[model samples]
Target chain A: MFRERLAQDAARIQKQFDLVLGALSDVDVTQAMSYATQGGKRLRGFLVLESARMHQVDIDRAIWPATGIEALHAYSLVHDDLPCMDDDDLRRGRPTVHMKWDEGTAVLAGDALHTLAFELCTRPEVGTADIRADLALTLAQASGAQGMVLGQALDIAAETAASPLTLSEITRLQAGKTGALIEWSAGAGARLAQADPAPLRQYAQALGLAFQIADDILDVEGDAEKAGKRLQKDARAGKATFVSLLGLDAAKARASELVDEACAALTGYGASAETLKDAARFVISRDS
Target chain B: MFRERLAQDAARIQKQFDLVLGALSDVDVTQAMSYATQGGKRLRGFLVLESARMHQVDIDRAIWPATGIEALHAYSLVHDDLPCMDDDDLRRGRPTVHMKWDEGTAVLAGDALHTLAFELCTRPEVGTADIRADLALTLAQASGAQGMVLGQALDIAAETAASPLTLSEITRLQAGKTGALIEWSAGAGARLAQADPAPLRQYAQALGLAFQIADDILDVEGDAEKAGKRLQKDARAGKATFVSLLGLDAAKARASELVDEACAALTGYGASAETLKDAARFVISRDS
Candidate 1:
């Protein structure tokens, strides 16, 4: 029954996202926008919706925030693929926006997506100005150089250094680069649902760390066909990874332990949080 | 007396900008942020103070909004200097952020600056949340692709294309690329001053256009030494130019006419608008 409900919510939210993406299409910007938005796992959106459900918020009220998170996630991917950044030519079996058009267009498209996220969140009719402002601030903190931007900076810096990262360093990098946004997605949904901040933040922190470990493990062992992109690029890049440092099996075990902690963190929220609990399970269980 | 007041205002605002810029210094992101913010005319900052002066608003109340606009303006310049965009190697006699640091640093620095703008505007002590939100939306609209971003896209597209652009096309490009932020800076100050939207927007639009025309004229005739950067590069690149289309003298004359129209638009606001009127004259009269 929970699975069915999750599917229903996903479908409904995906349709709303389609409308959001469709409306963004302009003659000059449409192609880049389509490339950025299409074929993502929609993991961030799921986090927003599922977390909102945990607080008994209706999916309709959660959809805009969900879309906002997805837009930000997509934009990060777009910039991450730039020649000077991760330099990946392909994403999800398609040419990246930079590869399809030019780096300038990709950069601008990413920028537009970032602005669009804030714009969508601030839509006055959807939520109170305070809620919108809080969400905007939360997302900005997660996405800016102090968060994801700083992570990317560290990643780039790591490329030139010969020093091996300790576990703490690796976790710090992942927390900023990957975990920040994931945490923000959950936190934003909770904010939209008007949940208590203390427990919600605790839950998000654990889930975010678990999510990154899962991603690191997937990069090591996940199938290319299922993952829809090149696998093992992380190892190839000489970048620090949980699987590389902790060993694959240990990384998998750590992810499971983190997920358990994440589930435990949500206990006070009651049965409404079952989807988020399942999401934690899904984060570690997925091959992709 | 007016010149002294304007100078004092500029110094005071620059001090505040220095504080904001100084906060980023300890972080690795400082180089790019410094590169982007340290120099330039502070025209947007000027507009912010001048607009507030029209309503006899406290300079302290106006400082945050001015800083916000400057932040936005700095981010735009950083992104504009990226290789995929303007590819500018030098700005203000120094290498641009992208040229000085790597492109990734430049990108992150721009993103951080953009977010910082909102952060400054939304400081709880600065104003009410409603005012902060309004300022953020106004600045975002001006900076986003639909406004400045789209203008830049068109500017770039026109640069590489074989098609001849009409004066209307040039006007549209300038309005978006350069004019939108100018308009926002003016309007945001007016908003802070609690001026009615009608007269404020009218003055803003005209001033914005006049500002662009003056910039175009300066690019043609100004000395590189005085401008603090290379001149004639625009012509060398065969980029669209008002001087190229209208002849050097005609462009200069048109810029002066725009100043007149811009100042005339402020007539409804009374003698208190003298700073803004002087700003318009400065726009057309200055060598740079």
Candidate 2:
């Protein structure tokens, strides 16, 4: 069920991106944006659409935040692929933005996509003005200095640090890096509906950690071709990750436990949240 | 008189920057954000506050977008100074963010500041939700692919082009690169008041063009010590600019004429808009 929904959401989100960016005169940047945003699992968008459905919100309003999160996520990936950062040549099975065009284009395209995220949230079709403002504000909190960027900074800092990060430290870093946006996407529907976001927030917190644990496991044992990007980089750099810190078996067990906890948090929504349950389960099981 | 008001506005705006960024936990990025934002002319910020004042808007609400524009502008400068971009070492007489910190921090700090711009605009203190959404939406329009980023991309493309840009090409580039933000800042007050932004748009279009023409003039004749960053970069690269397209004498005359036109657009505001008139005149006259 979640697989079909995820594919549909991805197509719908891509169409919305086309509608938002198709008219831009900077075809190179917009084209790069489309490429970067394409082929993601659309887990964030699915989380947004499903959460909105659970809240009885319209798909029209939900698509705004859904697409916004994906754009924001895509921008992060583009920047992270820069020479000074991840320095990766391939992403999503193709040349990264910097590799395809140039570093300057990648930077500008990433910045433009980042700006587009907020623009989408502010669309009148999203919801009331207040809800739009809330979406923009929360997005800033999730993606800014204290959130995703902070996590990136910490990750960078670890490269030169005298010692590897402990389990707790890596947890905090992953919470900021991978968890913040997931939590925001999951809670966006409740924000639009002016309902309590607590349950979704709890579910997302566990799901995000589980997602990262699964990623660490993949980096340890998954196929490089299936991943479509660099893997086992933590081992290459002698960096500590969940798999390194917890052992592969322990990491897998922890991920399974977190998925259970994530689903348990959705008890109030009953069967309506089963897709989200599937999503949480899929996060741990996805090969890529 | 305008100098003193501009100085006060810069100081007040800087204080707001401190307030907004101080609460952030990522000290390194926040520090870089502050350093990049400091000691500039604050011309864009002053336009926002002065325009808001012209609309009889309170300073409390006005400062949000005022500071927001400055943050957005600062982010552009930070990224533009990167090694993959302009590769500048100095900005505002201080080492660039990448020089002071590292490329990773510079990238994250710029991203954070860009996010902060929208976050500030969404402040409840700024105005009604509709107004805040308008600010965010317009800001995205002014700064995204078809606006500032588009301009930067063109400028980058110009570096390797077989031929120099024509006068009209440079004009279109400058309009997107510099004119868009100035137009947005100058028209912000009217947006907040739900007034027609037409006159300020006309005024800013002329002012922004005039401002770039003056910058070209400065690159030819101004003191680098006063400018605080590299000057004559266009000439050094053999690139076409306003002064190259038009003779020095003709360019100066054209800028002065633009100042007059920009001032004339404010006839609807009477004496209340004298500061803006002074700003138009100052854009061409200032050394930095």
Candidate 3:
């Protein structure tokens, strides 16, 4: 049931992206934005929709922020895949934005997508103006220098540091890099509902960390074809990862523990949050 | 008086940037963001503040969107200066962000500043929730694919085209590239005050076109040292510009005419708009 719901949510998010980008001129940058936003797992959007479902927010309202988060995520991926950053040629089994087009198109497309995120958030259909402002504000915080960008800068700095980052440093980096967005996604429903987000935030904190650990484990054991991109690059680069810090078995164990904690955090919502708990478990078990 | 007001507003915007970026970790991206935002004409911010003053908005409330526009402008400049983009090495008489730091740092810094723009717009001090959302929504529209990004992409595509852009085509391109943000800045005060923005919008349309024409004229006639960056590159690259399309004499005459139109648009405000008229005159007359 959860897998089916996730698939449905992903399709919905893709449709939202189509609706948004289709309004743009058929230029290279707009086309690149449409291309880059396609084929993601849409986990962030799912978290938003599912959490919104639990909060009983209208799908009409929820979809805006769901699409917004996905757009922001796509922007980050497009920029991260640039030659100056990760330098990856493939993403989701296709050419990266900068590889498919020129770097200038990629940069502009990413930037447009970044603005699209806030644009979607502020759409009147999303809710009262206050809700829209709150969403845009929190998103800026999650994605800006204090959050995702800071994490990325730290990651780049770590690559050239004299020694491998300590486990705590790696955790901090991952929190900013990935955890911030995930937490924001999870908390969106409550923000939209104007309810307390403590439980959802707690759930996402564990789930995001577990997600990263699972990613590290996948780099070690998952098939390159299944992941649809390069694998084990961290190990090759001598970058510290969860698996690098803890033994592989211990890392797996920790991820499982995090999943358990994630599930526990959803106790307040009881069976209504079962799918979200399943999402937590799936984070560690998914091959991709 | 207009020059002094512009200088005062520029310093205020700079201080706001310092306060915002100062809260972040002393990382390369944050430092690069500071450097990139350090110097500029601050014309957009000045427009925001000056228009806000005309509308009787308080400085504390007005400063947010003023700073927001400047941050957005800085983001555009940083990205435009990248090796993959315009490839210029000097800006404001200093090394470009990418030249000062690595490309990754520059990219991240630009991205952070882009987010910071929205963050500033959504601040509580900016206005009520609806007004803040309005500012962010309009900003996203002005800076996104339909506006600034579209202009930039067209400019990039024009580089490799078999023929240079025609007068009408370049006019449309500049409307998106530079005119959108200028219009937004000029209208911000009216938006913040919930007043009609039509007059300010008209004023800015003329002002922005005049500003671009002046830039083209300066590129041909001004000193590189005074311009604080490379000049005459448009002519060298065989790129179509106002001066190329209209000739130096015609371009200057057109700019002067636009400044007159700009000042005429401000007649609704009577003597209160004298400074804005001076601004329009300064747009065409300034050395840099």
lDDT of 2 at B110: 97
Name the candidate, 1 or 2, with the larger TM-score value: 2
Candidate 3 chain B weakest ten by summed lDDT: B14-23
Q: Ranking by lDDT, best first?
A: 3, 2, 1
Candidate 2 local distance difference test against the native: 0.91
After TM-score superposition, the amount by which residue A64's alpha carbon in candidate 2 deviates from its true location, in angstroms, is: 2.2
lDDT of every model, 2 decimals: 0.76, 0.91, 0.94
Q: Is the docking of candidate 1 incorrect, acceptable, medium or high quality?
A: medium
Error of 1 at B130 (Å): 1.2
Candidate 3 total steric clashes: 0
lDDT of 3 by residue, B1-288 (tens): 899999999999999988988999999999999999988889999999999999999989999999999989999999999999999999999999999998989899999999999999998889999999999999999999999999998999899999999999999899999999999999999999999989999999999999999999999999999999999999999999999999999999999999999999999899889999999998898897
Which pairs clash in the backbone of model 2?
none
Chain B TM-scores of the candidates: 0.93, 0.99, 0.99
Q: Indicate whether candidate 1 or candidate 3 has the larger lDDT.
A: 3
- Screening candidate 3 with a backbone cut-off below 3 angstroms (N, C-alpha, C), the clashing residue pairs are none
Q: What is the descending TM-score order?
A: 3, 2, 1
TM (chain A) per model:
0.93, 0.98, 0.99
Candidate 1 lDDT by residue in tens digits, B209-252: 77776677778778887887777778888877787888878887
**A1-288 per-residue lDDT for model 3 (tens digits):** 778999999999999889989999889999999999999789999999999999999999999999999999999999999999999999999999988988988999999999999999999999999899999999999999999999999999999999999999999999999999999999999999999988999999999999999999999999999899999999999989999999899999999999999999999898899999989988999999
> Candidate 2 regions off by >4 Å?
none
